[model samples]
Target chain A: MSQILVEALAKTYRVAERAPGLSGALSGLVRRRWREVHALAGVSFSLEAGELLAFIGPNGAGKSTTVKILSGILRPTSGRVEVGGLVPYEDRIRHVARIGVVFGQRSQLWWDLPVLDGFDLLADIYRVEPARYRKRRDELVSMLRLEPLLAQPVRQLSLGQRMRAEFAAALLHDPQILFLDEPTIGLDAPSKLAVREFVRRLNREQGVTVLLTTHDMHDVEALAERVIVIGHGRVLTDSPFASLRSGVFAERRLHVDFAGPAPEITMPGVTVRSRDEGSLELAFNPADIPAPQLIAAITAQHAVDDIHVDEVAIEEVIARFYDLHDAREA
Target chain B: MAPLRPYLAAFRARFQLLLEYRVAALAGFATQLWWGGIRIMVFAAFYGAHAAAAPISLADAITYVWLGQALLALQPWSADPEIGHAVRTGGVGYDSLRPLDAYGFWYARSLGWMLARALPRAVLMVLFAGFVLPLVGLGEWAWRPPSSLEAALLFIPAFVLMAALAAAVLMLANIVVAATLNERGVNSILTPVVIVFSGSMLPLNFYPKAWQSWLHLQPLAGIVDVPFRIYFADLHGGAALQGLALQAGWTLVLVAIGRLAMARMMRRLEMQGG
Candidate 1:
């Protein structure tokens, strides 16, 4: 059985609607109107133990709502979930004891207290033994290179520094599963890379199941073996990273850095995206013309040097996918 | 009994957080002293003329004002702003994921903040009013202990507990307002109530004979009046014990209600969008 199991999960929120303007506001006080919003229509997935899955989606695509439900924070309007053979919301305390969650935008540490003090408080809260807690804190502090920051107040730490502390704080209890909600958001490139590396090690070495939701495509490529693409509160695609990239966006890019000034070249199916002094980029759907065929056709016309081929960026793929989805819905 | 270590750790953490803002505490001390002086001038005028006709003597009245000023931090004037903001911004989502019970955790922390705010201020205010002011020949205006220092000191534990409970009750109430009414509504609902009934403005007797009984039994009265009355030996042995019992009773009831409300509010809790 998978460590995390969710099926046909759905959630709707009842948001109060206030009329605009002074007259609308006055009438709203007498009797407010409410509109039901379906945050999750039907999101279903299962996570096997030791799996690192990246859940990707556009904003308001229910990525968070889905994560919240799985973490036992929000109740689903409909569907079933069994995380570690326990219904998270129903068995909250016991379930929460076994799972760690890091919300990138929120810090669990006391803002005014030193980072070490917050760790100690969390240790008490999680009921971690003194010996084990010390060992774990030392290990994580060194792992994240947080020893120099141990005595600093959290409010004084930079966003990157705080997130590192947050990661250690979440893991102090030695939870079997970790949920990272946009863990790399707003991080500098090196910080993002460090976080990705840490999460990869945590998943691979410790066999810790990680469900990472992020918008940074590089994070997905670096850490996740499988990617789950969600849109409109439903699973649009789920497969191995390589397969998902090809399946959802069969388009690929070819960059030819010429020996000198680049030549303007276009095939029947290929579109020239940009041209620079010594290079040009092309976008082509694999279905329109196989990448090899396009390359061969390209070499037939101009001298090719330092040629590179890559898939379309995940952001662009998702954007075009959403445009297709919205167009279909409209 | 529940292991108190976790609660104690929370308490210590909260205390440390409050102490970090030492400048604010100093400002608070100055503000309370200023208020103390004004109350003295006004009450001295009222009592200097009618000392014979008053129920509480001039000395007791002045003591009441000083003690109220010193112990002012103990009142549940507002919800624990951190937890309240967390709930408002949905930061509470991560907060609720913690293993601790929200009620006990917040209660312990809130009590910790109050004690941190109160302990030093209370000591300094008492020393300044009782010792420094009197040394300057202001004894008539300074705070004085009642006939028995031992008895007054003895009742302090009960008063502090009562005040902490009142704070918890008020903090819990603000959650309901914050979750439903948002942040503005929290200020609108709580500000007036904290100022009026919490005894910061004036004593219950200052109102009217008709409202005295009800006013004295209020949660704020437990915060200021009951504690000070015990210190003044206004309510002796049996009555003092009864007062402590009543405060404890109210605490249990209010905490229970607060816990249930918290559990219910969190059941469908929502916060800042992920």
Candidate 2:
């Protein structure tokens, strides 16, 4: 059975409307107007146990709305949501107790208290038994390598340190499902890798079902096996990360460094995207021409010193995919 | 056991957070001291001129001022800014994620804040006014301990109940602020009204006979008037029980209102895509 099942979920936000300028502001005071913003328009998805699903969307695309509903922090305008066989909003307290959530931009730890103290407080909040709490707390601390920073106040910890602490805090109860919203956002390269690796192990080893939402495509590429692309509050595409990369934008990027001057040689399938003094970049659809043929053609033209080929950056693929999704809807 | 661990932990956490900012409490104490000094002088002069005409003896009036100063931290109004900031900045989303009931969690925290700052300042002020200030020659303007042991016995329970009511009322106001999201209106409207009407600015007895009776019926009177009357021997057994009943009634009423408001606001927050 699926650990999380959401069917035909919809959420509408009643937003207060006001005209611009002084008169509009004053008129709003007496008689306020409102407009409805449909955050989610009948979204549906399911996550089997131990699945790592990356939910990708643009701003206000309802990624957070869905996550909130699934985490039991939000009530849907309509439709159904269940986590661990419990209706999230209807059985909010019970549903939430079984799932852990981490919003990247928010820290759950108390700012003035030491990191360990925040952990203790969370242990209490989750009602973890004292002996179990101590054991779990120490295990997470050592796993996260949080020993050195345990005594320092949360305010004093670096953002990277704080994020790690947040991860440990959210896991203190050993939640069956983890919902991470932009968990790697605003992190340095190393920190991002650390978080992604931790998430990967948590899913693979502990079998914790994860629903991740992020704008960072690297995070999606590195962590999520399946990607759910959302735009305008609708699921645009749901497929494996590899297929999504090639399905919309089928081109692979090739970088060639010549032994001498780069030649302006034209090939049937490959198109040069950029050229410099001794190196040239090309894009070619592998469907039309295989990568080996393209490389052979390049070697035949130029005295090659070094060559490399990479799939089009996932970020660009997503941007183009969003454009396709948006155009289709329009 | 249903497990008091979570609420107790939240309370302890909140107390520790307030403990980090004792400077704020100290600043509050100094401000209250200055205000108390001025009120005491004004009341002492009035009672000296017309002792028979005064509504309370000079001792009771001065005691009221000092108690007001010490207990100012316990008011529902002063903590509104913190709750406002949390809601406006969207930080309260984390709070909503916790497993505990939102109303009980915050109520415990509010009480923790009261105990952290208000309780200590109260002890200090009572000691200084009862012993130090009187020996230093402000005899009638200093605190007079409860007249009989019976009064202290009555005041303790009343004081505890009043604090619980204040916590509930403050939590209710915070839920209103969260639901409304009108920080400026609450700041400009709610705070001033609470400060003026809570009898924190001036004791209700100072008002005319007709106004005093109804003013005692207000929620803030349970916060201030009930405790002071018990300590000052101005209230006996029946009246003391009545004061306790008023606080208990308000506590029950506000707890109900607060829980309902919190549930409604939580749904509203969810609908708003919190």
Candidate 3:
């Protein structure tokens, strides 16, 4: 059985609506109008133990809503969600004990308390035995390089520092599964790499199942083995990262820096994407013409100074996929 | 022990954090002193005008005023500000992630905040009003000790129950804030109601005689008038036990209601933003 299973999940929210002025406000007070928003519409997915999956989509795509439901924070309107043989929302307290969650935009630590104090509070909250807690606390502290940060209050830490602390806080109980919602949002390049590295190690070395929702394509490329692209409250694609990339856009690019003025390419399966002073950017489908064949064709006809072949960036691939499905934010 | 650890840890952490605000405690003590003085003078004037017809002696009224001033923070003046902020910012979602009962977690923290703010001021008020006034040749105006040994003994449990009742009431206010997504409406309504019915503004006995029984039985009365009256032996013996029972009963009732409301609200809680 899958460690986490969500089938035909649906959630609807009733939002009160009002008009634009004081009169509208007064009329709203007398009689209100409510509109229903379907945050999740029959979404389904399942994950095995130790699987690392990335949920990616544009804004308002219901990724976070799904994470909330799986973590037992929000009850789905209609669905069957089971984690480790227990329904998430029904057996919330027990289910939560087995999973860790980090919402990057929110801090679980008390703002006024030192980082270590927050850890101690969490240890007690989880009711970890004192001896086991000490070992776990020390391990996380050293793993996250939180020794110097232990004494500083959470409000004083920089965003990167606080995010590290949040990761440690979530993992102190040694949960079997971890949920990260935009965990690298607003982080710098180095911080993003660090977060990715830590998550990878936790998943690979410790064998903890990871379900992450992120907008950073690099996060998906570096960490996730499987990718689920969700939009319009439904899963658009779920496959291996390599397959998703190829399935979305098979076109690869070859940039050739010719020794002289760039020659126009008049190939059957290739097109000139851009012409620069001394370089030509050519796009081709590897299935139609292999990269080596295309590179050989370009060099044979022209004196090539520098030549390289590269796949399209993941961001562009995802954007094109969304466009193909018309899944841009409404 | 294991089951209660989370709530106890929450309570201890909040209590310790709040106690660190020494300057806020000093400022609150000063404000309470000023108000206590004004209320004492008003009572003295009223007693002078109606010495024979008053329900209680002026000395007892003075003691009542001082107790009210000292423990003024014990009143459920507003929902816990932290809970209010969390509800507004969508941080309350974190509370749901914890492997603990949400109501018990919040109740522990609220109890901690109330006691930490009240204890220091109560100690300071006792030293100044109960000791300094008598030393400075103002014996008649000083906050007197409990009327008898038994009164003093009974006041201990009464005081503990008072804190429990206040925390329970504050939990209801917090649920309202969470449900409505705004604290201002509930706070404005709660503050005045707590003030008048708790007898922080005036003695419950001083209210119209016809309303005295109703006022004495109300929940807020356990927070202020019942306990303070117990300290002065006005509600002694069987009356004191009844007052304690009223405090216990109200705490249980409010806690049950709060738990139900919290469960219902959380079922449909829609965190505001991504």
The per-residue C-alpha lDDT of model 2 at residue A26 equals 100
DockQ of 3: 0.81
Candidate 1 TM-score, C-alpha based: 0.91
Instruction: Sort by lDDT, best first.
Output: 3, 2, 1
Local distance difference test, each candidate: 0.81, 0.83, 0.92
Per-residue lDDT of B168 in model 1: 64
TM-score of chain B of 2: 0.91
What is the TM-score of each candidate's chain B when compared with the real chain B? 0.91, 0.91, 0.98
**All models, DockQ values?**
0.68, 0.63, 0.81
Where does model 3 sit among the CAPRI classes? Answer: high
Q: Give the winner by TM-score: 2 or 3.
A: 3
Q: B1-274, model 1: which lDDT tens digit per residue?
A: 2477777888888887787777877788889999988988888898779777676777878888898888777876666676767666676777668777777777787788888898788888988998998999988888886658756765777676666667667657666765574656666777678668756677666777888878877765666666677788876788778667767777777888888887887776764376
> In model 3, what are the clashing residue pairs, if there are any?
none
TM-score-wise, the better of 1 and 3 is 3
What are the models' TM-scores? 0.91, 0.92, 0.93
